[model samples]
Target: MDAKVMNQILEIAFEKRVSDVHFEVDNPPFFRGRGQLIRSKLPKLKPEDTEFIAKTILEANKRQLDPSLREQDASYSLPNGGRFRVSIFRQKGVIGIVMRVIPPHIGSFEELNLPVVLSEIVKAPNGLILVTGPTGNGKSTTLASMLRYLNENYSYNIITIEDPIEFLFTSSKSCIIQREVGIDTEGFGAALKAALRMDPDVIMVGEMRDPETIDACIKAAETGHLVFSTLHTQSASSTINRLIGNFPPEVQEVMRQRLADMLVAIVSLRLVKDKSGENIIPVVEVMRSTTTIQACIRDGRLDEIEKHIENGVAQYGMQTLDQHLIQLCQQKIIAVDEAKRITRSMDLERKLMFTS
Candidate 1:
């Protein structure tokens, strides 16, 4: 491995506050900062140089490291509080490495500019609260923030299971036990099943990777352990479907009822650059379970679920993505033009602007 080049690249990555660094053949190395991409200081990496850089990352994982050259996915901690989830692979005979910089410190709700209601969610002693979004949409940051909130305010045992374990947290009011996939445990399903026996008061599953893990999370919540998880779905209803759809058709109904019963809330978010083109703002859609909503979830009326979320804002803590986007625009935290683009309901964005 070209140790010098790799060291220089890490230096530049940390200096820029970049959240990720991507290297591939024939392209200039670039990194992500504050949700935006910035060019890397290192010149375009040659095929040979990229291979060396990729190998440097794999060597850090002794057990997972392969001398015969195989794709690997793991997290690494850099000097000065930088952490990354590195995935090394070969694409079209060219070495490629994608490293996502873990935020050095987890932020709180106020620090992340999330809704105050989130604090209420974290305060729950038991139930399932999901914060979900498409990849790179700041779901981890939000989840970290909520977990940090609990870390600071409550005196309880909080456990988290992450694939690569991004965003490290320090003990505060809560004692945290973080287990990473492949490192601390076998996999998501096994870790979740084990967490039940760990006697945890709160459990955070990094992402619901499969049916078994989802089932265990629901069971954990049902058994009086507050649960938090993520799914790669855009909205609340879609998140519900993603969970139920993971199971086979024969038992889907049973799982749906289980999900409906233990589910407490869901936060779906997207991060958009602000008006100044400086930083990103989080646009979220929230669904807090109510009698009517829980009833719809049980009866298979998922299609009509939006009405309750969009129309019952005052009655429940629910807020549509469009609602949050409009508010961001109104506050001038994000540009109206960009906000309109990412918003799910462009029609609603237009309508709300006029009424507000």
Candidate 2:
């Protein structure tokens, strides 16, 4: 709870390249490194320790982490030039905190090892571009890289509505305005609607959490503003279904049509260690909105989308998850068994076998 102790814990986490630090009662602090939970070599923390750390972070950020209410999400900046996104909540009626380490430097697309096609996608004049995956899979980092690329390459007014603003971007060739949900404006929907009136050329919604935010993002894209957002889905088809599922059954069909019109691309990613198990690389599934893909969405033929992604890889710059895994395996970036574990398609399994 003390600043000195917190700094020490953070130093250890940073030095070990841990993604997250967790504190809970009756448990020693844990570090999530390379997607594995590693217990800290320290004594178990008491309830009071977690409570103190939670309150300390909240107070320093000038926010409240009231367990009686809902959980709190906030950002914290360390004195030694580190930033963290902190989630404080009640678990088993005790205080608990999870701090995700946000990298200070936003990496370029090449540095993040994203595909070259992403550079072309990010330069779209207007429409919705989604970078999706489950939690802790570098979705935010990927989105940040795209935005950073735009910031460096183009001259546009970019406005971002983030729950807790993660990567801080100074003005480059583009004019950037970042609004934190609680601190900058009322909420995501409000900030997004207001951003539209602000004449923004590019809008970044941190996460399309609810129907309201999703609707707002779609409308923003429809209005000719290049929009970027994230979803917690595994594949492009599932991402479309998840978006339409947010609306009522009666409106889902209409929403699907609207999404089909405005959708630009969907990139789903997963981070897996390389063959040596030393470095993590992203295996991506990309689905660009081509005429065939749009028809599938409009006709509600979601199941047919994957085949299109596979066949249209060369034509549309789209690739399925299995395709990416196969490439990684062929390149020896990942082992054959690792690719098999990550992929689900028998078709792709046979392809991997034959290719290997």
Tens-place lDDT per residue, model 2, 274-354, is 988878899999999999999999999999999999998887788999989988878889987777766767576689778
Number of the top candidate by lDDT?
Answer: 2
lDDT (Cα, tens digit) per residue for candidate 1, span 16-62: 76878888888788888877677755567788877777666656654
**Weakest lDDT window of 10 consecutive positions for candidate 2:** 61-70
RMSD for each model, in Å, please?
1.9, 1.3
User: lDDT per model, in order?
Assistant: 0.82, 0.90
- Model 2, which residues run further than 4 Å from truth? 346-348
What is the overall TM-score of model 1 with all chains considered together? Answer: 0.94
RMSD of 2: 1.3
For model 1, what is the C-alpha lDDT against the true structure? 0.82
TM-scores of all candidate predictions against the true structure:
0.94, 0.97
> Which candidate number maximizes TM-score?
2
lDDT of 1 at 101: 71
Candidate 2 structure lDDT: 0.90
